[model samples]
Target: MEGRLENGQYWQGWTVEAPVGVVVFVHGVHEHGGRYAPVAARLGEAGYACYAVDHPGHGRSPGNRGNIDGMDTTVAGVAALVTMAADRHPDVPVFVYGHSLGGLVALTYLTGERHPRVVGAVISAPALDTSASNAVQRAFAPVLSRFLPDLGVLALDIEAVSRDPEVVAAYRADPLNHTGKIVARTGAEILTAATAMPARLRGLTLPLLLVHGGADRLMPVSATEVVRAHAASPDLTVRVFDGLYHEPHNEPEKAEVLTEIVAWLDAHLPPAPA
Candidate 1:
């Protein structure tokens, strides 16, 4: 199903009959929720409902492409979908799956006031640090964001996305994917938000799973290690797929990641009815 948020931003969902739980996906900076259809469908077949929203300024959503007002706005967007998922499937547990930039947003939301509503979350290749940004880009981003927020500063290394050549080919061909430089303000917001997470992560007590590719160059596995180190979640699990690229789920060995995710979800499901 397709719908709009209170702010009229577009979102989509995939459902299954008598779902055991709901999983909401938060996509990265340049991509839309539609890219996750196959992954969501898999979850649906596993008896879990899944939903995703095109972040403002992304995909079919209305806004200047490749830019965002702030991380607060981004986090609020995730909050809206989380609420929608819970309202649509009351009595069923809800989980969050965030990749890259979305992972940071999900982390911010989990550390926020409404996190208790979520049972657990799967954080994949979170953008917790910007190692790719040159010293000049990092130095200028904040000042530039204040002045020319729309200025494009850095572009992602497309080859770093996945080791599978076909996946890279599809990503390059996907019209919905914004293959452009990261805007100044968006870059600033992501950097600022990520810088604040280590402290906030210490407060997280909910069940959590962090996954990443050991060979990922975009968002390094070390950043995820930092999350594993700081997150206070007693039930946290970390999986590092050595030699895989950024998108482990899209990697040739995707089943390994998906199977682990499903197993984790099964283990974390809320208690059955009395």
Candidate 2:
């Protein structure tokens, strides 16, 4: 249910008996890991256990909301959770799934050195590049990070999160869904990581699936294209949902998206015991 990492980060997860596989999920910025309960339930029904950790400054974890010293902290946090999952279910294959900002962290974890091994990965609408509208902030981010690292930069426009009005309302009402400004340091780190992602992706050799909404206003489909083109993974698959917004998991076509994910994961499943 709930636990604290030795690093003092708060983590939450759900599991099923005799799971066929495991998935370590990482949530996006300004949102806690708990929002994926429904998605986890679907995966659980398919015989996959799901574990997720709230990033340092987000969710139930303690830190300045929307602030992190660097992306390494987030990457390390996900690696820890993967290790925990492996310890608990050594026989089951573990897959990492990340949405939006979490997707960037997941990719980083896979591409980074000295990280835990996973069977495959799912990246959904990763924030690989700064939105065109935020170009000014991206330009000034470095200077601001040095002087006002904690300074609030931009507020997420909730409407851009999903096409469903109900989902929008719930996100707006969710207390854990942070509505604060993105810190200067966090912005800079994200921009830096995104800039470096193309080269980093060229070295990723694991089974991978990249999903994105063609209509997503935040992270454009072109970002996913870059990842697909550069990722050296022999089994990389890219799916672009034409009309959906940012969160396909919350969109009206979510069932289709989930089906696609389950199918990909199942194809890569470790062989059944005799």
Give the winner by lDDT. 1
* Model 2 agreement with the true structure over 1-274: per-residue lDDT tens digits: 7798889888888999999899999899889899999899999989999999999888788888877667999888888889998888888888999998898888888888523548899999988867653677778989998999989877677898899999999998998878887788888888898889999998899898999998998778987887888999999999999989999999989999999999999999978889
Clashes of each: 0, 0
Q: Candidate 1 deviates by what RMSD?
A: 1.2
Per-residue lDDT of 1-274 in model 1, one digit per residue for the tens? 9999988778999999999999999998898899898889778778999999888788888777888678888788889998998998887999999999999988999999774558999999998977777778778888999999888888789999888999899888998888999898899999888889999999988888999999998998878987898999899999999999998888988988898999999999978878
Q: Pick the candidate with the highest TM-score.
A: 1
Q: Which 10 consecutive positions of candidate 1 have the poorest summed lDDT?
A: 109-118
Give the range where candidate 2 is weakest over 10 consecutive residues by summed lDDT.
110-119
Q: Predict model 2's lDDT versus the native.
A: 0.87
Against the true structure, what is each candidate's TM-score? 0.96, 0.95
Error of 2 at 49 (Å): 0.6
